[model samples]
Target: MDMEERVVGEVLVVRPVGKRIDASGSADFKGKMVDRINRGRNLIVLDLSDVDFIDSSGLGAIVSMLKTLGKKGELRIGGLKETVDSLFRLTRMDRVFRIHPSAEEAVLALAAAKSMAKAPA
Candidate 1:
């Protein structure tokens, strides 16, 4: 799986340029995410606009990424196609991830959350 990684403010945006995230790409996807997290990227936004399909392994890899982040980081998903959206909804993974219509929206939301966290009580 080929992914483009960039930073927008404090969020790390990872856009995977692949039509399907199945058994073949799941490991790569998970590894990329883990690498970002290990490198001190606490805010991650996955841009999945190009991904049209994902299998159980792919979903499991995403869940594993979330678990790896734990309370130290956060993961958000954006630009989900119909097939991918249905899979997430059907599997109740939508509730586990913060889904957005676009990567820009996810970045904005994450930025707001970061600001809020830094705000003084």
Candidate 2:
């Protein structure tokens, strides 16, 4: 799976340029995400606009990425296609992830959340 990466402020937007993230590609996807997280890419937005299909392996890989970021970083999902979105909903993974309509929207949302976190109560 080929991935394109860009930075929006402190957020890294990773767009996988493939249609499927199945068992074949899930390991690569998970490895790359882990590498990024280990290298300090904490604020991340996974843009899935091009991905229309994903299987259990893919979903598990994503969940692993979230666990890898536990209490230290965030993994936001964005631009989910209809089928993928449905899968997330069916599996209740939608509730586990902070889903956004687009990568830009995710970036903005993350920025807002960070600011709110830092705000004086």
Candidate 3:
């Protein structure tokens, strides 16, 4: 499973290049994401536009990544294609994640959230 990692301001955008994220690749995906979180990348946007398929293991892997953040950071998902979007909706993962239409929109949303967090109450 090949992934592209980039920084959009303070958020790290991770885009997996593969068409499928199944049991064969979930472990590696989780490992890489954990490593990134350990390295202090707390703000993230997972861009899944290129990915067309994911299994339960893949979904678990993503949920694991969110847990790994554990109040230290945020993980937003974006660019979900129709089938994947349906899966997320069906599984109720959409409610668990802040899904966006594009990576740029996800980054902007993160930025806005950060700004709001920094605002005085």
Candidate 4:
């Protein structure tokens, strides 16, 4: 599992540079995410542009990450390929997460939300 991590104004952008996230890569993906979370990086935007295929294990790993984040953080996904997007929609995971058209949009949206939360009422 190859992943690139970058911080975009409080949102951690994680781009997995792989064609598939199946049983073989799920554990590595989950471990890397957990390590980041344990390191105190909360808000995340998973960029799946390079990922063309995913299996149940990959989906499960993502859900697990969301659960681990819980109330302390947010997990948004972006750049999903058509097949991956269909899977998320079919599994109703799309409703469970904020799916963005692009990573830039995801990061900007999260940043805006953060700014709004900190604004004086």
Taking all chains together, the TM-score of candidate 1 against the true structure is 0.96
The Cα error of candidate 4 at residue 45, in Å, is 0.6
Q: On residues 2-121, what C-alpha lDDT tens digit does candidate 1 reach at each position? A: 988899988999998888889998998899888889989989999999888999999999999899899998888889998889999999988889999998899999899989999999
Runs of candidate 2 exceeding 4 Å displacement: none
* Candidate 3 global CA lDDT score: 0.95
**Model 2: per-residue Cα lDDT over 8-120, one tens digit each:** 88899999998999999999999999999999999999999999899999999999999999999988888988889999999999889999998778889998998898899
The C-alpha stretches of model 3 lying farther than 4 A from their native spots are none
Worst 10 residues of 1 by lDDT: 30-39
Predicted candidate 3 versus true structure: per-residue lDDT over 34-116, tens digit per residue: 99999999999999999999999999999999999989899999899989999888899989999999998999999899989
Instruction: Kindly report the root-mean-square deviation of model 4 from the true structure over all alpha carbons.
Output: 0.7
- Which residue runs of candidate 1 sit more than 4 Å off their true CA positions? none
Q: How many clashes does the backbone of model 1 have?
A: 0
Best by lDDT: 3
After superposing candidate 4 on the true structure, give the runs of residues whose Cα lies further than 4 Å from its correct spot.
none
Candidate 4 per-residue C-alpha lDDT over 1-121 given as tens digits, one digit per residue, 9 for 90 to 100: 9988899878899999988999998999999999999999899999999999999999999998999899999998889988899999899988899999988888988888888988999
What lDDT does the true structure give each of the candidates? 0.91, 0.92, 0.95, 0.92
TM-score of each: 0.96, 0.96, 0.97, 0.97
What is the overall TM-score of model 3 with all chains considered together?
0.97
